[model samples]
Target: MTNETEVDVIDPVAQIESYTKKDFQLTRLPYDFLYGLRNNKFQYSQMQVVMADKASKEGVKSFKQLYKDYLATYHSDEQMLAVNYTEFDGQPFQLACGSYICHDDIALLNSNGIVEEICNHPVLPCVRLVNIDDNTEKLIIKYRKGYKWREITVDKEILASASKITSLAKYGIAVNSENAKGLVKYLTDIEDLNYNEIEEKNSVSRLGWINNHGFSPYVDGLVFDGEENFRTLFNSVKIKGQIENWIEIIKPIRAEKNICSRIMLAASFASVLVNPCDCLPFFVHLWGGTEAGKTVALMLATSVWADPTMGAYIRTFNSTAVAQELTASFVNSLPLVYDELQILKDKKSFDDMIYKLCEGIGRDRGAKNGGVQKIATWKNCILTSGEFPISSEKSGGGAVNRIIEIDCKDKKIFTNPSELVSEIKQNYGCAGAIFVKWLQQGDNIETVKHLRKDFYKKLVADSDVTDKQAMSASLILTADKLINEIFFNDDILLSVSEMQSILTTRASVDQNRRCYEFINDFVAVNYNKFNPEKDGYNGEIYGTVIEDRIYFIKSKFDAVLQENGFNAKAFLSWAVENKVAFTAEGRSSLTKRICGKVCRCVCVLSVEETAEDQLLNNEDLPFD
Candidate 1:
């Protein structure tokens, strides 16, 4: 009997397997046996018998207690196990698990012999488990914010530290402190688990509220919400009224009777639609005197995508260039409208703003952590309005070329401004959506590019419009033609002649012409200061009376130039090259000696003569 008992003890597999297969009630398992099964030294069948026998002998009350104790002892010493999980992007990640356990509330199996459940605890979507030894492990987890992801690594000691769950929650994880051990165990044991499986699928993108998949938080449209490979349509925009109301509001502007209104409204809609095509972004500066319907035109433009309220779709010039850049980035691919250009305090900032907007990219900047920040970029039309043209006396040809200035001198463009404004406030943003939907129907981007190129070449060949201006006009014309024919059923066709006339007017006032205009305006405003016969003059004449001769105090001349956005030296060079101003000796000079002191003076024909000279030199000049 002693020898037989020794044999049974020595080879316990049969007993263990038999007890495991039996339908028996048990409570506890032997520590050594549980540990062996956890470490793969014994099979699961052997573990069952050891646990049942131990529970029976020790009076373990319930299977739950028995299982919990078994797991505790099994996972006491960290052991590496294979784990697999799928990321939010549907990518698979594999790692070694260090420990695992069944959750308390989520029961999986509640049979006579076995009770199992999964750990119900929030865990890092992705974690790296490394075994340092039989008793120690390291874990690396990935934390995500929007499109950016960061990895954090910690040892077992650090993970087990106080408030570990709270620390993890700071990184977008939610886990109960009591379940931390179980979570670690489950992650270590599970061979396959979906880390980011959610009912509603939403992915992160680098672009501001606008996703790379062409979904924008601000614009109403169809969005694909799910994994990139699989997506479902979601209507993102909530319209306040029926689409017919919007059409009713736009009908008056679109009617053939109001050509200016039709052209302006079409251009506004075209601006929003042209973003998808391959073309350079340009500005449409609507300028005229007070009450000339410039603001109404701007409101018309703003109504295409958003409310025309002062702070809604239309931004003001009161903001800094940096703010504008950020706003441009946020609006991505949407027309940016700036109202009342006169509010721009600094001319240089305005010039920089125009160039930056036209360039379609922001300045390179560094982050707080010494890393370079992502540069903001956009492709869309910029609409601006003011009493005066955006291109001023100090603007360069490059800056002037990027803008298509429209003279909104027709104050009667809208019969009742108040009523029209009220209509637009109630009915807007539908046309923009319609335009986007129309574009998404087919592959029309290539067609747009081809048409833009063709129009650009034709404009260059037929008119004196510069290549850049031609490019800008061509995009608008192409969009106008397509929109009139396809979307509006050819209601308001924007002919090449109209585009040519617009470009011709803009081309007439180049940088040189603007400088001359500024000079004339300055002389007019300070005529008394320059004339000896005027009451303002205390003593002698401030300017030369000789024919084709003009003299100004160097200090006063620089002040005027600086106030108008011109660098005196550069403007002098430009003036001399253009024959707008010259020195007495027929030489190019910015400063000369007058009254035993250095002063600035220029010899030029009368304003009338200069206008004639301009017309003779540039046939594109609009003035006689």
Candidate 2:
């Protein structure tokens, strides 16, 4: 036998004389090791093995656990052990046969300590599981990867798989074949321990009210359960800087009387009011030339609720339509925002985005197993910005009510926008949650409802506001009033007269008239694509110009219009009625022999004739 000093779990060096007095040996090695570890007289997990003989093997059962074999060796049954197998009452001290370790035990080498002594295995770094999500169907393990902790949700059956064991290496829990069964046993044994301490609230994937409970993920009686990679979605809706700092930087923005700044901020708040106010989703588009501060204004609006930096609360137009829908659903009642509309390659894609983002529901997709996947839906205002207008002349007339196009004006909205960007990024995520909390307090939600109604009534009665336009406008104004009262303490309020400039009338958004204007613009830009001037040119011909009349090829004209989401036949009808397109003998189109073939074309007045006609119709028209 050899002498080995046992290290105390707490005071490692304090008990040097006590170990020297004992003269402990290798007999009953399993029992002594287990007892010493359980009693805190030794450290097993971090111990170094200095000596070995005959190659130690792992023991599944304790030496004292062979009770039946001990009795069988003797003729008669005895009080406990027929032969004394362990040091303490023929049993391992402080070792309970219950499902798991007792709460009161101060143990280093768990599970009898026999395995470590026999196999020379270090004690497993026991995992500290946090019951974050309340799903009994699965087990969620929260483990430390160095200093920071991460979560992995897994089914109970797959807890000790090879992949899972490898995944746990980063979590600091070292496991091998000899100790794999021990780790699994430890986890399953403690699954129900301290059951009452675990919070039993369900997890949520969206931002707004989870149920009648009225708890947002931001407020955190609930855990965020978005896709594992989308942790930023939940993290974005958090408070970083103090609320006072947010208010201080944001107050002057409201006071500036800048339409884009004020309206974008209000729109951020208005998304939450969509449910309470019983209104539909709409778009607030801020567009202008370069350096007009469109994206900066978007960031200011986004800061009202979240981090205003790109890819944080604000997304770009680089994502696909399906990805955007998923993002919308995740944001839920929060304002769904995007910057740099120019990332989208074409006009048709933007038009399609308009309908999809405003639809309030995601596409019904099928699951891999069959049936349908969970349908994602939301109520939110969509905020967007770009170098050009969101809605062009060819946009759907219905899209008019669904969107509010604000020109960023001729000059830059902010002379020094980068300074504002730096401030907002650091001092955001304060107001959005507070605004929601303020509304939920007492009769405040009801108050907002009434404000929306009052504004809508006044907007339609006094001004030429369409119902949809009035609805969106009223919500924004009401939001403006709420935030002003909460922060600015009632500064120079944005009046209805000033706000009315943003609403587009039915005449302006009329699809037919827009289509007619689109054709005129198209012809002017592509004049070189037409003929006569460039005869025998090998470039693809769009039309043939004969004197003042340009005959656009019917196929080419229809295809281009359709590609741009315009109704070509409807545009032709309106163009003929307006005398912009010339028809032969009251027919819809004319047949002309061009390029050595009989071809059908829409013979239209040149751009000069169309402009001169418009000048003649207006008495107040100015001549340049």
Candidate 2 local lDDT, 1-624, one digit each (tens): 211344334342233222321122323332233233323223421121111110122222232233222223321322221111212221112222222222111111223322121111112112223223323334556443333445565544456454454454554555566556656655553344424433344555567654455636555555555566567867787777887988888777666778888888888888899977778889999988888888898888888777887887788989888889998888878888988988888776677788888888999999754699878888889999988888876678878668988888756887578888998889887887788889889999889999899888888876657788888989998988888888778465766766677797755666766665566678788877876447567777787787668788889888988977788777777777667687778666789887777778998776566565673443222321
Which prediction has the highest lDDT against the true structure? 2
For model 1, what is the alpha-carbon lDDT of residue 26?
A: 37
| TM-scores, all models, native as reference | 0.61, 0.67
How does model 1 score by TM-score? Answer: 0.61
Please report the candidate that would top TM-score against the real structure: 2
Distance from true location, Cα of 566 in model 2, Å:
1.5
Clashes (N, CA, C under 3 Å) per candidate: 8, 0
lDDT of 2: 0.65
- Per-residue lDDT tens digits for candidate 1, residues 185-215, read 4544442343333111232221212423443
Shift of residue 318 alpha carbon in model 1, Å: 5.5
* Poorly placed runs, candidate 2 (over 4 Å): 1-138, 142-151, 154-202, 415-419, 462-465, 519-557, 569-624
| lDDT of residue 614 for candidate 1 | 60
For all candidates in order, the CA lDDT equals: 0.57, 0.65
Q: Model 1 Cα RMSD, Å? A: 11.0
Model 1, 189: alpha-carbon shift in Å?
12
Query: Which residue pairs show backbone clashes in model 1?
Result: 28-55, 29-51, 99-185, 100-185, 100-186, 101-185, 101-186, 103-118
Q: List ranges where model 1 is wrong by over 4 Å.
A: 1-70, 73-252, 256-261, 272-277, 285-319, 338-348, 385-398, 406-443, 457-466, 504-507, 520-543, 553-556, 578-580, 583-593, 596-624
